[model samples]
Target: MATLSEIETWLHDRLPALLAEYEVPGAAVGVSFGGEVIDHAAGVLSKATGVEATADSVFQIGSITKVWTTTLVMQLVDEGKVELDAPLRDYLTEFVLADDAAAAEITVRQLLSHTSGFEGDIFNETGKGDDAVEKYLATLAEVTQLFPPGEMFSYNNAAFTVLGRLIEVLRDKPFDACLREYLFTPLGLKHAATDPYEAILHRAAVGHIRPTPEAEPVPAPVWALNRSMAAAGAMLAMQPRDLLAFAQLHLDSGKAADGTQVLSAASVEAMQEPQVKVPALGLMGDSWGLGWELFDWAGTKVIGHDGGTIGQGAFLRVVPEHGLAVTLLTNGGDLIDLYRTVVGHVVKELAGLELPALPTPPAAPVQVEVDRFLGTYSCEVADVTIRQDEDGKVWLDQTPKGIFAELGAKPEPVELVGRDEQSLIALKPENGFHSPHVFLGDDGTGRALYIHSGRAMRRAPA
Candidate 1:
């Protein structure tokens, strides 16, 4: 591990230029290694306000909040109050789905691992009340199930909302209160908060969205996601430092800095162990753990998660064996590029580890037989259609659903190239990064495309 002075020196020398190269408005980073920590922040928090960023400036850590949610669930497991294998209906009696049989079989483990296989993206506002998650659960009664329970890996935000409700029921308190009492307060995270109302009490960064590649990013139209989706990725806010401190607990076997046991050592290990294989979606992790994404970088195990919300992006990566964790929180601009540059440097410098290289496209592209994947594939918040043109060029038409569609959204057609017999990559013409659109083989049930962050978009009935 690099010394604190060395890490600070590297950040001062390297970060600003990289941020400028990526056009990132602002970013904060935290590195924890060998029981030492260093934090760095750069650029303005918002282009409009011109507020300088600081290490203490809280950015919505987006889906990075999933690990925290899962930590609370594991704490309940430690108390013998919750069982990972038990059906979720065992806890939330009001839980129902369009597919009743599958709903009855979904387990707590599946929810944590994102294998619940239901329509994942439901962003209905349930109002910011104690009953928010309850109302969210009620709305799922009409949502469709994309896969049978535990059948395959599909990123599901709705699953976490369900888990959020379970937490409310099990703790007999609101989700935010339970988070404060069980995780944030116990860990002494002074600035950590679960909703915008609480986050505004701290130095919070506003999200920004760019209209085009050359356009300047402006404040995002939406301030925060619906409270109903809080557990999934709605409202958690914290600085990179506190986020790293939380990761340190996992590295310390669930023991806080003061030697307080927050989660059992066994539960912590289970949370990092590989639970199910994840489809390739340009993510670093090859598999999903209880809540963490498990990555194998040159045969060394790394665990962490990435989060995005309203143009804000956050990444947390932990090298448990090396006692190292690094986080990057940014408000806008080519986030994936910034993450690759910043986080790629941190791992290589501090831990003697190289992050995964971006996947290269095929040397010779092959046209796909569009008919096989031609049907409409639907999920909770989006539908994707595979189409072929007169020249036999295959592509995918992705259309947002629900609230997004109501706001004048339109389908985006991304060109596809065959990576293999069963897999295709949606090539973003500008960057050429390969986002895998793999076809999970039909097994009598139906054919499906694992798109939208590896969520299964099953073909509609013929």
Candidate 2:
């Protein structure tokens, strides 16, 4: 393992090149091991303002906040105020879905595991107030149930929103206040905030977006997600060190730095226990736990989560056996690429673990009959269509659904080059990144099964 000085030198030298390479506006990184923490920041907070980024500058940590919310729920569990297996309705009596039966049957476990089988991405704008979460839950009555409760595993933002509401109801305060009291304050995370109003009080980074393939990224108009989605990872912003402090609680067996039991060790273990097999198709992690993505990195068990909102992205990973964790919080740019370089280097240097390789295409592209996949496969968030033109080249076209469609999101058309009977990667020029697309099989009823980023989308009926 490299010495601390070596790691610090490497970061200082390498991060600027990465920020430029990825077109990222700015980023902050934190690494913790052996009672020492290394936090660093680079690039400008925004290209427009030219504000230099700092280790103390806050950026939305996105869905990484879900684990924090999960920790809050687990605290309630430690106090016997919530049950993992209990129906969500037991605590959130106001919760109802388009499918009344599903509303009655969905358990807190299912929600935590992303197995609730409900159309999860309900980004309906609930007004900013203490009652925002309550109003959001009421809006669920309009959302269609994607499947019966607990029948399949699909990422569900709405489920976490409900979990956020659960915290508010049980704690008798707003979700933001509850987060501060139950987790942030006890851990002394002064730089962390859960809403835009609070975030404005700090040196928070502005989100950015690349308008086109060749244009420079500009500042995003909307800085935060709809207030209703805050619990599902919309609102929380923090510096990298503050994020590591939160991760430290998990690495320390759920005990705070002051030796207070913030979460029972049993509850912590349960959070790491595998709950559902994620559909990464050989990329990312193999499964999902309560609020964590479980990875088998070089035979070591690593638990972590990645979050994205607007154009910002954040990542948190923990190697508990080594008492090591690494985080990346970025406002924009090629985040996945930045993560692979930074996180990969740190883990290899400190913990002797190599990060997963990015997906690559085979030297010779394979060809297959394209009619088999010539249909639409969809989930709540998006839909993808596979088709073959008269020239006989297969293409995959993907677009947003539900809330995303309502917001007028655009579709990306990728040229699909087959890798096998079951898999392919979007064929781009050598300079472009190749993302894998796999056909999982048939989902019965004569519909083709497809997996993208660990979420299953089946053929949609005409």
Candidate 3:
């Protein structure tokens, strides 16, 4: 195994060059091992101002916030205020969905495990009020139930916001206040920021985006997404070290630095237990626990989650068996490559495991059953249309909607190559990685019922 000193020296010399090579404006990485934390940073926090990134720079952790929200729910569990298997309506009676029957049957476990089966990417603008999160619950009134509740695994951002609202109703505080009082304060986090106001107090990184695939990245038009979706990872910023501190608590079975029992050991263990198998889609983990992504890195159990908001992306991985964790936070530019380069190295040399290699197109394109995938799949955030042309080249075209459009997201179209009968790899790279698409279930007309790229989009009716 590589010594901690050896790892630190290599990262200090290597991070800056990797940022330049990957075209990321700024990034920070924190690693925790043997009860100590080490962090490194490189590049400017924003290309426009050129403020150099530092160890204390705060970057948005995105949907990694889901785990935090989950922790808060588990605290309620530890307090005997919530039951994992109990129907959500039993606690938050105001919780309603378009499918009232399915809504009544949804359990707290399904939400935490992301099997709520409703359209999950609903990021509505609720303004910046303390009631922003509460206002979000009403937006789900017309949300489409993609499947029966707890039927299967589907990534659901909206569900976490629901969980956040549940926390508020039980704790009698806004989501942000609950976070401060419950998790941040007890964990002794110094640089974590829940919104733009707090983030601006620190050296904050602005996300960068390439206007076009071949263009150099520029500063994003907005600093963060709306406050309403905060629990769903719309806007939570912190230095990677602070993030690792939170992870260390989980590694220590939910005991905080001051020895507060923030979560019961049983809840921590349940959070890491596999609850459902994910679809064959390569975009996410092999399966999910309560809130953590479960990965089998060559039979070595690794738990973590990745989050992306606007142009910023965050990756977290914890090896509980090894008592180790690593986080990489970035403001745009080939995030997956940088993550694999940094986290992959730590896991390999330190824990002696290999991250699963990302999918790549075959050298020779193979024929696929394109007819079955030719249709439109609709979701709240975006619509994906798959079609094939005369040369038999298949393509997936995505058009962003709602909050995504406000943040300057544009229509993206990529050619698809056959990866298997049910999945395909994008022939073109976005942000330096090919996106994998998989068709799941049947829509009764021999068409795919859902098109999955992390979040599942149901097939649109003609």
Candidate 4:
């Protein structure tokens, strides 16, 4: 095995190349092995000031916070304070779904596993504070089911808020306090907390977004959660090393380095057990366990989660069989794309192991009469021009910049995948120029609409 010093030097040398290629401003990374932390640092903390990142800089860790919340709930389960299978309404009387009977069927286990069918996110349109959370829970009566409870997988944030509410009811304390008492304090995670109201001016990494090609990267406003939505993604301001400590605790079966039991071994195992099948995301196979993702990398079961906020991206990966963990926290929007590469490189360097290569998407087939797919198409979001190349492959020329040629010679129809209700396909090509084109109408003469982040557009005259 490579020495920790060797691994750190390798990362320090390669990480700068990645940041420049991906346009990320700064990152904090930590690695743990054999129940000990081997590496920690802040890299390129600020782009504008050239300030160096340090080991203690705090970054928003988006959905990775879900793991902590779920672990806390499982502790309650182990203590018999809460039953995983029992319907949530048993503890939270305020829990009312659009369908009262359906809402009554949702369980704590279902909520953590994301099978509750509750709508994904309900950011307190009413603003932050205890009243907002209370009002949102009161309005659950209007939240309808997307699928029957536990019958399918749907990543529902509202369900997690309900779990947070349950914690409040059982402990007679706010969710943040409960987390501190049960999880953070037990593990000695001093910098981790869910309370966004606390002053965090210093030791925090500013969130940044790479909005356009020409524009300088912009810092996103510091996002604070209204007390109501804290459970969903509100936990903030953690050093990458602190996050790694949490991962090590879990990898060690919830035992702190001092031998204190932070969580039961069984609870940690349960959190990594796959409860639902996830459709593929690129080279990554999908499966959801408790609040973590379970996937195989080179036949070793690697479990972890990725988090995204306004201007931050964070990732945690653990290989239990090898007793290794890698965590990366970045103050940029593009951190999502860096997870696989960073973790894979660390694993190879430290353990001399290679991750399984992403399966090759099938090649596009031979084409004939590609003209019907050509010409400009427009939708409510943006315009896309489909043109046939000399090689007979179809290319989508998208507006605002970038081009996405069809993947393979034979273009596969875009299909809906997973419970998250996102559309994807094997071999789909996307780039700066290509917009996420949705084929509308029959006969292939329909407009293409950008799904989430494009301005509205109308079809130009033929």
Tell me the lDDT of candidate 3.
0.90
Better of 1 and 2 by TM-score: 1
Cα lDDT tens digits, model 2, 1-462, are 886668888889889989999888899999998999988899998888899999999999998988998999999998999999999989989998888998999999999999988777778887888888888988888777766787767788889999999999998998988888888888988899888888888888998876655667788778888888888999799999899988999998898899988888998899999998865455456788999989998689999999988878899999999899999999988887888889989999999998876667678888755666678877767778888888988788878876556545575677878777667777773123577776656667444555544555656767
Which ranges of candidate 1 are over 4 A from the true structure?
A: 366-368, 406-412, 429-432, 443-453
Candidate 4 residue pairs in clash (backbone atoms < 3 Å) = 128-226, 364-408, 364-409, 364-410, 365-410, 380-457, 401-433, 402-432, 402-433, 403-433
- Point out where model 4 deviates above 4 Å: 42-51, 130-132, 196-201, 213-216, 283-285, 356-362, 365-462
Minimum summed lDDT over a 10-residue window in model 4 is located at 401-410
Best by TM-score: 3
Tens-digit lDDT string for candidate 1 (1-462): 567678888888888887788878899999998898899999878887888889999999999889999999999999999999999888888999999999999999999998887888888788989899999988988888876788888888888989899999999999899988988876888778788788888878888876654577677877678889988889899988789889999999999888899999999999998889987666658999999999999999999999988878899999988888999999988787888877888788778898787665678876655566666777767778888789978788878887766644564587887876667776663322567777876636444444434777776665
CA lDDT, candidate 2, residue 99: 87
Instruction: Sort the predicted structures by lDDT, highest score first.
Output: 3, 2, 1, 4
Which portions of model 3 miss their true places by more than 4 Å? none
- Candidate 2, position 90, lDDT: 95
Order the candidates by TM-score, highest first — what do you get?
3, 1, 2, 4
Better of 1 and 3 by TM-score: 3
Q: Which pairs clash (backbone N, Cα, C closer than 3 Å) in model 2?
A: 279-454
For model 4, how does the per-residue alpha-carbon lDDT over 1-462 read when each residue is reduced to its tens digit? 776677788777777777777677788778998655755554565565666767777777887888888988888887889888898878888888778778888888889988776555555444555555556788667755545688656566677777887877887887777877887777787666465545264466667755443345566544544457677775556887778888888888889777888888999989998987654443323678998878776567888877766667788888888888888888773454565577777888776667665433235432333343346644321355666567644555555221111111223232221112232222342221122322322333543322221111223457
